[model samples]
Target: MPNVVEPKLIAGNANQPLASAITRRMSIHRGVHIDLVDARVERFNDGEIFVEVFENVRGEDMFIIQSTSNPANDNLMELLIMADALRRSSASRVTAVIPYFGYARQDRRTKPRTPITAKLVANMLVESGISRVLTMDLHAAQIQGFFDIPVDNLYASPIFALDIREKFKDRMDEIMVVSPDVGGVARARELAKRINAPLSIVDKRREKPGEVAEMTVIGEVKDKICVMIDDMCDTAGTLCKAAELLLDYGAKEVHAYVTHGVLSGPAVERISNSVLKNLVITDTIAAPEPVKGCEQIRILPTAPLFAQAILNIWNGTSVSSLFETSTMEPIYEGVFRS
Candidate 1:
């Protein structure tokens, strides 16, 4: 609110809808309508990425919103290039606002020989001259340590908890939050605590990629409405399999609330045909047309959360306050349910 350096928002082609929504929320927070920076991002005939910042960004604080989803490499390259352009143009600071950090699943090596792509990506951003990084619900929390610069890893539990409260307020007692895999129990427990529901875990085994060997319900889900929570849902195999196991265990209904819906491969089709009643996801990654067409899939906007974080960062205030579930109301209720 005080007279200070105004931050300019520049969007990459990764997720324009989310970027636009963030800017709108930023406008309301600043009490004045703010516009996105004018920029052009195109590719040459040989598939070389090109970027041009038309307006002057010298001495300005710049926030580039880009999600490394779907075409992960291209989007990542665009972000790096944009940062390079802004830094070369004399921007005071560049903050890379990434909603869905791709390659995060490979934060560590599972086998004897494998690359830590998450750290590599972090190194790339830092080398590109980015002063800070802002991301949400990283696949692995430890990935924050991969970056030497300051990194803000925003959580989606508060947002998902609000939605769960509104949708199942009357059935809170009948609801049981579930973790599709042991790795996600912590995330699921956070939402369970917020909704005041019991927690359940799906003790599952994964033999290899895109496959679920076995899933056993670890808690009492019989006849209860089960809500599965995870950081990301890719291919939907694990979620769909877990839903089936829950139903088989007598769950009245099974739903999912995931942060990043990296619904690649047969995810859309699988969710549409799975036993899960509904699959609620955040707009961290842009949903494709087929995914949008699925009746069981729903997308929630995360702009308000990101916008608030950006505002706090610019004001030199604490960002952890944004993670407090009671700090904000359910502003995006019933907006993008499909």
Candidate 2:
């Protein structure tokens, strides 16, 4: 707080609701009220993005809150253009606070003639004059290495664990943290360690082309309240399929905790009909009407988590402490049934 100019926040059209929520949390955080930077983000008749800054941001700290969710390309462009404008306006430092980083799933090439889109995105953000980057639960952690600038990648496991503790207090011993597939074992293990629960893996494989993927639970999930963890849930095909498989294997109930709910295609419909109890997703990507109306889905606010991280970053405190603390209570609404 000692720096001459207070940090300024702005939003991209990708997720204005999330940006507004962060601003609200920042207002009362630590007895300090930070205002959103006055700006205009618009689109031209030809689909070209335009950004206009109304404030004199000379030597001021800037943070652009955007989630590169659906319409990833356009939202990504908005972030780049805003950073360029701030740099041209002489902002002291600019940090791109991306709640959901798109193109992260393609961190590596899976087949011949493929691209590492995640690294490409990292380079794009850096070239946009962003001095630093802050994001939550990237699809791949290794993507951080692609950025030459400082990248603060946060984890939602702590907050998720907080909700899990209270929700399953009675069935703590019967809880089993499950990784939907082999790729997410680490994420599942982290949550398992947090709540002192056993860990399990769902091994899925396809025997041939155009065939249903056969799944096998690697550990004892029979009679356990299976809690699956993953970074993102897109389409919901694999996630829902795994949930049904768990129930078929004799699990008492199944629940999921995913950071970014990209819920594209028939994801909402599938979750509504799936055997899972409920899907708890963060407010990273703005949810659409179908997603909101789905009774089987719930939302968890991540504003406090990001607000604390930003405050600590501005004050030059330990940002990692936010992840390590088990007792930090976040502001919440219990209606989501976390």
Per TM-score, the best of the predicted structures is 1
Per-model lDDT? 0.90, 0.88
The TM-scores, one per candidate, come to: 0.96, 0.95
> Candidate 1, residue 252: CA error in Å?
0.5
Off by over 4 Å in 2: 1-4, 206-212, 330-338
For candidate 2, which ten residues in a row score worst on lDDT?
Answer: 327-336
Q: Name the best candidate (by lDDT).
A: 1
Candidate 1: list runs displaced more than 4 Å.
1-4, 330-338
Where does candidate 1 clash, by residue pair?
Answer: none
Model 2 over residues 127-227: C-alpha lDDT tens digits? Answer: 88998999999888898898999999999898788788878888899999999989899988988998999999999886652234688889988999999
Each candidate: RMSD to true structure?
1.9, 2.3
TM-score of 2: 0.95
